[model samples]
Target: MKIGDTYFSADVETDGPIPGPYSMLSFALVYAGQYDGQTFEKPSKYDQIFYREIKPISENYEVEALNINQLDRERLQREGASPKDAMNDAWDWVMSLAGETKPVLAAYPVSFDWTWLYWYFIAFSDKGSPFGYSRCFDIKTAVSIKANLPFSSAGRSKLPDWLQPEREHTHFAVDDAIEQAEIFAKIAEWKA
Candidate 1:
């Protein structure tokens, strides 16, 4: 039987502005819900999730970026999972969660998270990215269009009270992913 699309809300913490040059320090993917064309079934509990901290791929990094997420690169280099292992595990988890359905990566803006994830998956996973090269859902853009606001004004801080997520916006990758997933579900259910 054909199943619905499974949306995984994603968030990545990087050591710098981009991948390769810097590194994806950590990341998270939380299963939000499923949509079978007509109806969206939001997860009863946001417990289905995957998270990993990855060793730096390169020595290059920015101090400013590190200050934001506060991930110690040196410590990660010694204790974190290797890129190859992390990506492979993430790919496997995503596939298992999706089962027969198509998996879509959802994020607040999508561009930044997608960039890092796509690059890492291509560079590390033998099977490549689970979302292919493109399947992504941008919650920011969705809200902008749905609420008839300009893209610049779509940031979380400016969202209507009803559109704001109930979860706290901690910078931690998993926390942010869960928060964004909540926003995505609310957007999906909103009437406009």
Candidate 2:
């Protein structure tokens, strides 16, 4: 691992309640211990983390998630790529990370992001996922069970021994990825 580098957290931000037929918009990767939540950051440094905004089919749109993005129109005009194109990019990114022992995807809400990505991969590739992995590790669930707390506990906990000093603004992709990373680090640190 290089010093002063982002920790290659894989993430996909979308405009929907669940990630299925919905378009993926505004993908980002943040460097841990670099810019992270401490400063303004963008997706220029993660060598293995790739992201793309895709135009979703009609069945993919979810009104609630669309409002969360707050950039549906702007993204459509600028960053929007076809679903196939974005999927291809993401698939390549996964292949690049094949070096990892278990080929992990760390995310806060794995149920949502993992499912959405799987659907897109199958649809885009016209086959099963190219990554050849069947399971994903949910960092949030790890943290929750490790500390024996609820998902909301992360927002309220403040003890460093329990967690890494309580991170804030953990809904967006980068921040959530960081949260997941924190849990992974702790798990590794304690040899759990």
Candidate 3:
């Protein structure tokens, strides 16, 4: 149930799917609740996780979602959060609320976010991961199977125009985490 003090949900942005070549741009965690056997609650979650956008490190490139974040490299280089500092801070924050035991890290695409974030941070921080947990759950995959959501190529375009800001939507890693949190609140049980 209680790990140390809190439960955490992780949000991650990656260069692309798969590991190694694809780097973790940034990540965030919401310590809303902790794993009690197998239950989660909305204790309190942050609206923002805020992390710098980094260049996508990839070997096999697919233009499929190249500009998903749509951030300028120059700007990112100037304002990027070093992988070491970012993960250390996030993990510390997650663990601070959790007990010594590892907490569940719920994410949209648990596999992609968890592995990418775990590997990237372990290597970058070189401190190894203090968040000792074995299982990572994928909300997206789970939701897709359960909700039967149809695939659609249209993303923002499918969204209302009023929702679209003139400037590119904040591509910072944390911003994405916030969005996912909101969606989860509405769907409750996860949907693709």
Regions of model 3 farther than 4 Å from truth = 1-6, 48-66, 141-172, 182-192
For every model shown, what is its TM-score relative to the native structure?
0.98, 0.66, 0.64
Residue pairs with clashing backbones, model 2: 6-31, 21-60, 22-60
> Which residue runs does candidate 2 get wrong by more than 4 Å?
1-8, 28-48, 59-63, 77-79, 130-133, 150-162, 165-172
Clashes of each: 0, 3, 11
Per-residue alpha-carbon lDDT of candidate 1 for residues 77-97, written as tens digits (9 for 90 to 100): 899999999999999999998
Model 3 scores worst on lDDT over the 10 consecutive residues at 151-160
Ranking according to TM-score, highest score first: 1, 2, 3
190, model 2: CA deviation in Å? 2.8
Q: Is candidate 1 or candidate 2 better by TM-score?
A: 1
lDDT for model 1: 0.94
lDDT scores in order: 0.94, 0.54, 0.53
lDDT of 1 at 44: 89
Q: How many angstroms is residue 164 displaced in model 3 relative to the true structure, after the best TM-score fit?
A: 18
- Per-residue C-alpha lDDT of model 3 across residues 1-192, encoded as one tens digit per residue: 344324345666555676576655556665434444445455454642434455445444445434875544445456767766776676666556554656566666566677876786677655566555455555554444444554342243343343232334365556555554544443443323
lDDT of 3: 0.53
List, residue by residue over 35-127, the lDDT tens digit for candidate 2.
222342333333333556566555456677766665564557565788777777766655454433234454555666677667777877544
